[model samples]
Target: MTSKPFNKFRIMMKSLMVCTALLGTTFLAKAQTWHFGPKFDANYSTMKGEGIKNKFSPGFQIGGFAEYNITKHLAIQPELLYSWNSYKKSDDFLTYYVNSGRSAAGNNVNLGTVSVPLLLRYNINNFLSVLAGPQYSYKIYDDEDLIKEGKEAFKNSEVSANFGFQVNLSNVGFYARFNKGLNNINDIDDRYEWKSSHIQVGIAVRIK
Candidate 1:
């Protein structure tokens, strides 16, 4: 049986897919103004909450992005990404888990997820632009650092706000973004709330 949170995440992803298809159909006539590219990124991410330490962990993302230019200065961009997000466990947390018989527990929380970010881009010049948007992430992999008694320790789906800027030089673009979870991700308890955040620095290569 699937977990309730996982089921809910699947539903949300399906809804997002339908909406994206409808939008694609509507904008097919203007496809000439669209651009597509592959993106690779390195990130430093950490989970923040009542009990966990905030030590950052290294991660990465591989993905593609599509953009529709609405004007010389404005565009809509959507990205599909597969990312590894990691957060380090604190000394105290590790000690507790070790005492509880989970002696082999890892020192970091490793999560693999697929994410979609719909952003509005504002170009200030040919080489620079600012972007902001909401990102949807659904977890597909977990290290289970927080799991206990067969119960999930985190929510399967997360909503985040992303803010950043990009620099373009011909077909190569470089960017940096900050992502912050907008909702509590702690599924195990009500006393200690959890939120995740990450910083990404990336390079994008246009293919179309």
Candidate 2:
């Protein structure tokens, strides 16, 4: 009985060792072929007007993304981002001072929002890919120099659609994305419907 038990123990140990070796090999293969990374972004923004032309303005965004490989031809990317989107307008100094009782030449309105995007990427080659997805955004802050005037507060939430492309290098990637707001950035009683749109470019580094 003792001899039989010893033989069984020996067989179990060998099986365990083989399983461990296989698992280690699989882990190494996955590590060598795939990676995930963090991303950072900068943006140029402008409002899209239905009947008016709006000028382009400067903006920025920062974010991180997890990239997963399905094959040499495809991948999935999901990201969480904080973006600043705004436009600027100049006012006459004498008119502004006389009307608003504030001694200022010109003023600017700045709007800030946070967004999350999930994208599906189709790789055209090792160097290029195209991405498209839906983005959800919330307005966190908006500052206006003429708020002391009778202007109401700015809107607070936004929903948008996102589309873009990615360029991949040895251990880094670059991307450009465009976002269009689906909802108004202002309330119903506001004079104009504040439509938001932006273009973002970013760099990414692979860590895993």
Candidate 3:
């Protein structure tokens, strides 16, 4: 079970790296105005599905981004990030687990993933911008000590949509974004579909 997902994740990561390298190299060669930076985020995440009754769980991410200015008010931003997301199961969910002949270790699920986001940013002014984009993510690690595999757990890869706003002053930037998963992540006999969603708040500092 884990082997299949791990293989899929490796393939996806390789493909994404190729794409990122091409895009970044092209922009670096031709674009005169560019900003590259490190970013850190705090995320509040949850799952929505038939059996989920828990609230949001806190997580975080750290990574880097490159912003290429296409015009005075329009820019393209691409990011490579390592993200962590988590959730707590409801009492009903735990009961269901135990009733299914599986021992309930705990109620928490933690997932670590590598994500790539391609964003189109529209600058309203020098100080503000609005961004929207698509993101691809591949799972890297998971905490299965509690919520084991085959227990309505998530899959290897996910696609999501993001929309956000950014405030920038000099070399400092602050952003908040909402991400909604576009595909089902459930793997428990396919009886119910689960989708992940989160709110990410982060700070970015330009270094180049």
TM-scores, in order shown?
Answer: 0.80, 0.68, 0.80
* Residue runs of model 2 more than 4 Å from their true location after superposition: 1-35, 49-53, 90-106, 145-152, 188-191
Q: What is the Cα-based TM-score of model 3?
A: 0.80
lDDT of 1 by residue, 1-208 (tens): 2325675456446544554565456446666777876788998898887556786789988767888889999999988887778876666664434423244445657676778899999999999999999999988766654554555566899999999999999999999999999999877656667899999999998777
lDDT digits (tens) for residues 29-143 of candidate 3: 8667777867888999998875565478899877778898899999999888878788766656654445442365456677878889999999999999999999999887775
Predicted candidate 3: what Cα RMSD to the true structure?
Answer: 4.9
Clashing pairs in 2: 35-208
Over 4 Å off in model 3, which ranges? 1-33, 94-101, 145-152
Clashing pairs in 1: none
What tens-digit string does per-residue lDDT give for candidate 2 at 1-208? 1224465345435534443454345446765654555567787777654322266678776555666788878887766666666575434323423443344412455665656787888999889989998888766555554433545334677788889888989879898988888887654234457677788888988767
Model 2, position 95: C-alpha lDDT score? 41
Instruction: Supply the TM-score for candidate 1.
Output: 0.80
Model 1 residue 46 distance off true place after TM-score fit, in angstroms: 0.8
